[model samples]
Target chain A: MKCWLLILLILFSQSTLSADFAVIVSATSGIDVLSSERIRDIFLKKRRFAQGKRLVPVNLLGSKPPRLAFERRILEMDRLNLQQYWTASHFKGVTPPATQASLASVKLFIEKVDGAIGYLPIEMVDDRVKVIYEF
Target chain B: MSFRLRVIVLMTVLSLAPYIVTMIVMGNVYRDDYERRIRDNMTHELDITNERIEQSFQSLRKDMAFIASLDTMDDLLTGDLDKRITNLLVLKKNDMQLIGWFDVIDTDGNVVASSNPDRIATSADSSGLFSVPIRSSFDDNQLGQLTIHYSFENLDRFLPESEHSHYHLIVEDQQVTGPLNTDPVISVSRVLTDWPAVTVTLEQERQFAFSLLNSAENLFVIVLLVGIFVIASIAFFVATIIVKPILQLSGTAESITQTQDYSQRVAINRNDEIGQLSHSFNLMINGMQDMISRLKAENENRIKLAKEKDRAEMLQDLSTKLSRYLSPQIYESIFSGEQDTTLGSSRKKLTVFFSDIVDFTSTTDQMESEDLTNLLNQYLKEMSDIALRYGATIDKYIGDAIMIFFGDPKTLGVSEDAKACIEMALEMQRRVRELKSEWGAAGYSKPFSIRIGIHTGYCTVGNFGTENRLDYTIIGSAVNLASRIEGQAEPGTVFVSEDTQLLVRDHFSMTPTSTFTPKGFSQPIQLFRVISSGVTRSEIVIEESGFSLKLDSQELTEAGRQDIKTRLLNLIDDL
Candidate 1:
C-alpha cells in the first residue's frame, strides 16, 4: 500500500500542473482568451502584443516571495534557477521583466500603465490589475 | 643542442613533468565534470523545454478548442471549410517556428477540420490527424473527441537552440510522454486508442556535449601553450647558469692542448671541483717548468765542462813538448806566451864568418877515443866562448868547422849588426890563435891550421823548419860564398870574400889572393888576405895602415893569429 502511495505521488508530480498565465484585460477592455503560449512569449520579451494591444508586462522583484512563487508556478523556475536564467538574459540585452514592490504596487502600475499586465494569487484579486494568464 | 641546453631542457622537463601531468589530469577531470554538469543541467533544461512545449501545445490546443467552441467555429464547421482554414492560417502566422496546423481525427477515422488541407494525405485516410480525447469545459460528452496539432516550435523563444529542436514527444504514448532528448516530438496525440490516427510532432532539444567538449578542448590548448612557454624559459635559465661554465672550461682546456702550452693552466674562479682542478693544473705546470729548468741547467753545465776539459788537454800537451826539448834560456824567451815567433822574418845587415881547422881529421885519426873526445870538447868550448864574448851566436859547428853570425834572429837593424859581426869574427880568430899557442906550449906535435872567411850582407833570419821542428838560421848567398872563401884559403891564410873587400875597398889594406875554383861552384872566386896583428879590441884600427901580426911559424899557430888579425881588419874595412 505504501508503495502504491509512493507511486501515486511520483505520478502526481509527473503530471503537468494546471497552472495558467492570463493575458488579462479590464472588463471594460477589448481583449480576451489569450493563449498561454502568447502570454509566455510576451513575458519573455519574445513578442510585444496581445491581440492588437501592445503588452505592458509588470513583475515583482526577483527576490520577492510572490515573484519566486510566481516564477515557480508560471515560468516553472526556482529562484536560484531564475537568477541564472536572468543572468543569461541580461547578457543578451533582453532584460527580465520590470519589477514592482508588491501586489499593491503591481496593481498601482497596472492601473496607470496602458495594456499593463501583472500577476497575483487568486485571493489577492483586485479590480485594478487584470491577470493576463495564470500558471 | 649544446650540453647546457640539453641539460636545461631535461631538467626543465623533469621539473615540470609533475605539473604538466597534474594540469592534464585536472583538465580531464574538469572536462568530465563540466560535461557531467552540462548533461545534468541539460536534463533539467530538457525538462523545462518539454514543459514549455507542452504548455505551447496546450495553449495551441486551447486556442484551437476555443475556436472550435466559438460560435464562428461552429458556423465554419457547419459551413464551408475555407473560413476555418483562414482562421487557422492567421494563428499559424502568429509564430515563426510553427508550421500550418491540422485537425484531429475521430475514432471513426474522419478528418473533422484542418488549417491546411494539404496536412492530410486523404480525407478518408485520417492517418495524420490526432484522435485523443482532450480535457475541456464539459467532462461529459468527452469534449466531442476534439484534438489539434500545434506548430510546437514556440518553445524556442524561452529555451536555448541546442536544447530546443533535438527532441520529440508523444503525450498520449506512455513510453514517450516523459522528458525527451531528441527530435520529431509529439507533445499531444489526439488519439483514444492505439490504432487511432495521431499527429506525430517534433520538439526542440539538441546535444550540449559538442559545446562542452569544445570549451574544454579550447581551454586545454591554451593552457598547454602557456605551459610550454614557461618550461622553455626555465630550461634556458638553468642551462645558462650551470652548463655554460663547464663548456667554457672544456674549450679552454682544448685550446691549451692545441697550443702546446703545458704551462698554460686554467683559472677557474668558482669554488668548486673545476676550480680545484684548475689549481692542481697550475701546480702541475709549475712542477713541469721546474723540471725543464733543472734539465736545461744540467745540460748547459755538461757542455761547459766538456769545452773546459778540451782546453786543459791542449795546454798539457804544449807543456810536455816545452819541457822535452827547450833549454832554460830559450824556453823562457819563447814560452813567455807574450813573444811571437811564428811570423818572425826580418831584413838586417849582418857579418858572417866561417872557419875550419886544417888537417884536424888526420890529427884525430891516430888518437885514442878518450883523447879525441877531450880534444874536440876543448876546441868546441873555447870557440863557443869566443863567439859569445864578441856578441855573436855560434850559428852552427860542423866537426872542426865553425860558422858564426852577428845580428839576430830577434833584432831588426843593418849597419850596427854588420859592425858587431866583424868584431865577433876578429875575436873568434884571436881566441883560436891563443888556443894554438897553448897547445904548442903543451908540446902536442900534431899542429892544426885554421882557414877563415868573412862576409857582410843583408840576410833574412828567423825560424825555418820541416813539419816537426824548427831551426833559427840566416839564409843568403852571402853565407854560401863566405864558406867558399874559407875553403880557398891556404893552410895558414885568412881570406875575405870579394863582397867584403868591395865594401871596405879604400879602408882596408888587403892583399889579393889567387883565384881558385871552389867546391859547389862552376867558377872561381877571388879572395883577399887582410893584415890584422896591429888590430886591438879597444882601438878602432884603420885597415889602410897595413899592419901585420907575428906568430909561431907552424902553420896552425900562424893561421890562428892571422885569422884574429884578419877579422880586426875586416871590421875596420867597414863592410
Candidate 2:
C-alpha cells in the first residue's frame, strides 16, 4: 500500500519524488562506515579501494527493485541517464557494478566477495552484510 | 564705480556667461543621468544576483535530490533500523556548506533521520528555503520529503559588498522574511519555475549606489569653479592694462573742463591705442591754447578801439551843447580866442533887433505841446536861418521872441549893421506871412503876426557870469531900450530906436509910430515903425472904406487910449 502511494505520487509529479536506500558491504570487508560519496564512487566504478581494501561494487538486476534505488540514491542518476553514463564510461574502460538477480543474491554477493559493496532494502538486511550508508 | 572696475566686471561677465550656462545645463544633465544610471546599474546587478541566487537554490535542490536518491534511502523506506540515515545526512550537510541542516522525513511526516541525532523521529520542521521530495526511484514511489535549511552566514557570502548594498528575501504564502532594506534602488522578485511557492527578492540602497555615480559630476564642478577664478583674475589684469591710460586721460580732461585751462595736457605714455589717443589729445589741447591766446588779443584790441570812439563822442556832444547855450558869434569869438570868457564887460557899438509874435502865449495855450513845439521849431528855424544868413548874431530866444545883434564880432560899419538888421526884421515878417498860410493847411488855425524892434547902441558886450558858467551877452541901457521899443511895436511892423534909425535912415523909410518915457529913462525916447527895407524903404498907401476910424494914441496919454477904446466899444454895442 505504501508502494502504491509512492507510485501514485511519482506518476503525478516528479517534483515530489522521494527515495530511500542503504549501502551494504561484506562483514569481512574491514570497512565499518562509508560516506555517501565513497559509496557512489564505488558503485559507479570510479573508486576501487577504501580503508586500504580493493573494493568491488554489486547491483541488483536492472529489472529488479534495488537497482533503481541503488542508481538513483548512490549514483545520483535516472535509468536513462545511468544507461548513458555507462556508455560514456565504456570508452574510459569502466563498467557498471556487477549485477545480482535479487536482494538475497546481492546479500550473498556482498557476503562472499571481500571488499565488495551493494545496496538493499532495510528489511532485507542481516548480520552477513554491514550497512555503510542509508538515505 | 570707476571705469576700470566696470570694464573688468563687464569682461568677466562676458567671458563667464557661457561657462556658467554650461555648468548649469551639465549639472542638471549629470544629476539626471546619474539617477537613471544608478537605478539601471542596481537593476542590472539585481538581475545577476537573482540569477546567482536561483542557481544556488537549484544546486541545493539538486544536492537534496541526489542525497534522497541514495540506495541507502531504501533503508529508510524499509525501516531505517538505527542511526545510519542520520550519519549519511551529516556527511551530505558537510558537502554543502550552505545547508543549515538536512532531515530525512518519513512518508508520514516524521523526521526519521537528520544531521542532528536529537532531531531523529521528531516531526520534520518544513520551514526553510525549499522542501524537496524523496522518492523510491525504481517504482516511482513516494518515500519522504527532504527538507533543506539554509545557513544565512554562508548564503550571504554569495552577495558581494561591491554591489553597494544588497538583500535577499523570501516571500511565501504572503509572508515575507529576510533582510528588509528599505529605500532600495531596485527591488526584484523572482518566482523560480521549479518552485512556485517560493519567491526570492533582491534589493540595493539608492543612496549607496548614487554616491559612486556622483563622482564625475563633482569633479567637473570643482574644475569649473577653479576655471572661473582664473578667468576672472585674467579679466581683471586685462582691464587694468587697457583702462589705466584712458583713466589718466579722462582725469586730465576733467581738470581742464573744470578750470577752462586748455594749456594742460595728458602726460601718459603707452605703446597701444591709448598712446595714439594721448598724442592726439595733446595736439588738440595745444591747438585750443593757441586759439584762446589769439582770441584774447583780439578782444583787448576791440576794447581799446571802443575807448577811442567814446572820447570822440564826448567831444562832439560837448560842442553841440555849448553851441545851443551861446550865440554863434559869442561862441565863435570864445572858441577862436577873439573874446576871453572872463567876468568882464566892454562898451561896443552893436545893432540889436528884438522880435515877438502877437498873442504867442494864447496861441500856445490853445494847442497841444507837440503842435506847439512844431510851430516854435518852424518859426525859430526860419528866423535863425534868416538871422545867420544876414550875418546877425542871435543873442538868445525868450519864448516866441528873438534878440540878435550885428557888429563887433564882424562888422563893415555901425551904419551897415543897422541897415542889415532892419532888412532881416522886414524879411522875417514876410516869411511869417508865408509860413502862417502854410501852417494853416497843417491843422494850425491861428496865424501869427510878428513885431520887431531895432536899436543901434554902444553896449557892454562880453562874458558876464559866475566863475562856473559864463553868459556871453550884451548888457546896459542900449540893450534895455531895444526890449522896451519891441514892446511898443505894432503887429506886423518894425520899430527902431533913434540911434538905429539914424544909422539906417538912408537904407529904409520909417513911420514915426510912438514915443514913450521908458523905465529908468529921464526923457522920452523917439521910435519909428519901419515898414520896408533894401529896395522900397517906404511908400505909405491908403485905401478908404465906407466908414473910417482912426486913433492917434501918440496924441493921448496911456489912460486916454484906454478910455477911448472903452467908449468906442460902448458906442458899437448901442449901434
Candidate 3:
C-alpha cells in the first residue's frame, strides 16, 4: 500500500512538472512571439538581437522542469547536448544564457532587465513579464 | 690603614666607581633603546600587516566590484546553470591565491554561483568580509551581491605568526584566528576600513621581545667586572712602587734609634722625591756622626786637662808644706830650679845669731804646763819674727834657744851681714823688754827676758846631713862663739863677738863685755853688747854689775823727761 501511494505521488508530480512553461521578457520590451529556432539561437548567444532589439537570456540553475522543457522544445537539445553547444559557443566568444536560482528570480530578471528573456513556469509569469516562446 | 692599602682602596674606588656607574647608566640607556626599538619593530610589523590586510581587502572589494560589473556575472539570472560565473570565480581565486570562496548571491540571499561549486544554490551562511552588488549590464539594475567568504586563514599570509610574534583576526569582538594570546609583551590592533567589524592584531611574547636587551645588559656587567679587576691590579702595582722606598726609610730610622748609631742610612735607587728624602736622611746621619766624634774628642781633652790641673795642685801643696822646713830663700831657690838639694857644704863667711829666753826652765817650772807652753810659744814666735825680718835663715831651735844665721844662702857683703845680724839682735832685745811688761801684766811678776848673741866669721854653711836627712845649718867655731856669747848675755840684752862687733860697729851701738872661751874654741872670743841703732841715736843704754838704765828720748814726754832728769840728778848726788 505504501508503494501504491508512492507511485501515485510520482504520477501527480510528473503531471504538474509537465505543465506549460513560457519564455518571458519584460512587458515593456515590445518583443513577442519568438520562434523556437530563434529562441534557441538567442539562448545559445548565436543571435544577440531580435526585432531590432538587443536580447539577453537567462536560465534557472540546475535541471528544473521548465529549463529542461525549454532546452527540449525551444533549443531542441537535451541537457548534455545543450551544454556541449554552449561550450562550443563559449570558445567562439559566445556565452550561454545567464542563470537564476528560481523561477521567481527568472521572472523578476525578465521584468527588470531590458531585452531580457528567461524560462519559467507559466504560473510564475505575471503582468510584469511577457511570454516570447512556449514549451 | 697602611699606605699601600689606602692607595689600593682609593685607586679602586676612583677607577671603578665611574666605570661601574657609566656601565650601569649606559646599560640602562641601551636597554631602553633596544626595548623601544623592539616595540617599534613590533609596531612596524603590525602596521605592515594591517596595511597588507587593508590592501587585500581593498583589492578584494575592487575585484568583487569588477566581477559584479562583468557581463558574465549576468549569468546569475539563469542561476549559473552553465557555471560561467563559478568558473570565473574559481579562476580568480586561483590567480589571486585566495584561500576563501567567492560567491554570487541572489537577491533572495541564495548563492547562484560560487568558487566552491557545492555552495551554489545554497543560502549563504554568513555575510562575506568583502562584497559587491551585481547589477544588470543592460539596465544597470542591482540584482545580487558578489561576495568573498574569507577564511581567517586567508589573512594568515598578511597576519604573520612566528616564535616571536603572532597575529589574530578579531570579528565582532571575537578572536577568530585560533586562540588569542591572553598576555603579550606587545600588542597592536588595527580595524579594517572596508570591513568595520574585522580587526587585525599583532602580539609579541614577553621572552622574545626583551631577549636582546637581556643579552646586552649581561655583556655590560661583564665589561664592568673586567674594568674593576684591571683597576685594582694597576693600583696595587703603583702602590708597591711608591710605598716600598718609604718603608725602607722608616725601617732605617728605627734601626738607627735602637742602636744609637747615626751611621745607618736609607738605601734607595730612584730619582724621585723618595730618593731625595733618603739622600737628606743620609746627610743628616753623617752630620750626627761628625758631631758625636767631635764631642768625644772634646771630652777626652777635658779629662786630660783635669788630670794636669790635679797634678799641679798636688805639687803646689807639697811645696807649701816643705817651705816651712826650709828658709824662704832656700825654698825659693830649690823650687825655682835655681838650686839642687844635696848633702854638701861650703866654707863661706856667715854671721851667726843665737837667742834664748833667760831662766826659761826655772820660770816655767813654777807655772802650769799650759801657761808654760803659751809663754814659750810666745817667746819663740817673737824671736822667729825678728829673725825672719832681718833676712836671717833660721838654723835650729835648741832648748829655749833659736840658732839663726845670715849671709849663707844669700848675702849682702860680710860687713852688711854683720850689721843686719846685730840689728836683728837689738830688735830682739827690745822686743824681749817689751814682752817682759806684757808677761808681767799676764800674772807673772818675773816675766821672761830673752838674750841674743851674734858672731861673724868663716863657717861651713850648707846642707850638712846624710843623704836621707839634711840640715841647713853652720857647723864651725863661729856657731859656738855665737852660743857662748848668748850664754854670757844679760837678760834682755844682745851680745856680739869681737868679729861681729867690728863688722857692725858703723850700723849699731855696741859695748865691749868680758871675753868668753867656749868649749871647742881655741881662742877667747871678745863680745860686745848691742845697744840702739847708731843711725837713729834716739836711745842711750847704760849697764853695770849693780844697775842698768835705758833712756829713749823719742819715747819720753816732757814730763817723763823731766822726771828722769830729776831721778838721774838725785842718783848722781848720791854717787
lDDT of 2 by residue, B302-418 (tens): 898888889868866886697887777777777788878789887889988899998999888899899889889989999999998888989889989998999867787998888
User: Which candidate gets the maximum lDDT versus the true structure?
Assistant: 3
Please compute DockQ, using alpha carbons, for every candidate against the native two-chain complex: 0.01, 0.03, 0.13
Best-first order by lDDT: 3, 2, 1
Candidate 1 lDDT by residue in tens digits, B1-575: 77777876787678778877877787779776865665566566565655665566566566656555432222121222234434554465454345435554433445544455564323434333343442222111232334444323333354454444443334445434224544433232222132232223333322334455667667867876687678778777877777666766676668766885666656668888767776776787678778878988999999999888888788768866864443232344467753345646566666788888877878888777786687677877776776666556557778889887765543334444444444455565566667667777877666456777877777776667753667656788778878877877755456776666665544444678788766677877778776442323223322222343553333446666689778859967974
- Candidate 3 yields a Cα-based lDDT of 0.81
The chain A TM-scores for the candidates, taken one by one, are: 0.70, 0.83, 0.83
Error of 3 at B101 (Å): 55
User: Which stretches in model 3 have alpha-carbon errors above 4 Å?
Assistant: A1-135, B1-294, B541-549, B555-560, B571-575
Per-model TM-score of chain B: 0.35, 0.51, 0.56
Segments of candidate 2 deviating more than 4 angstroms: A1-135, B1-48, B71-131, B143-155, B162-261, B264-272, B298-467, B472-481, B487-512, B515-575
TM-score of each: 0.30, 0.46, 0.47
| Candidate with best TM-score | 3
What RMSD does each model have against the real structure?
28.2, 15.6, 13.9
Lowest lDDT 10-mer window, candidate 3 chain B? Answer: B178-187
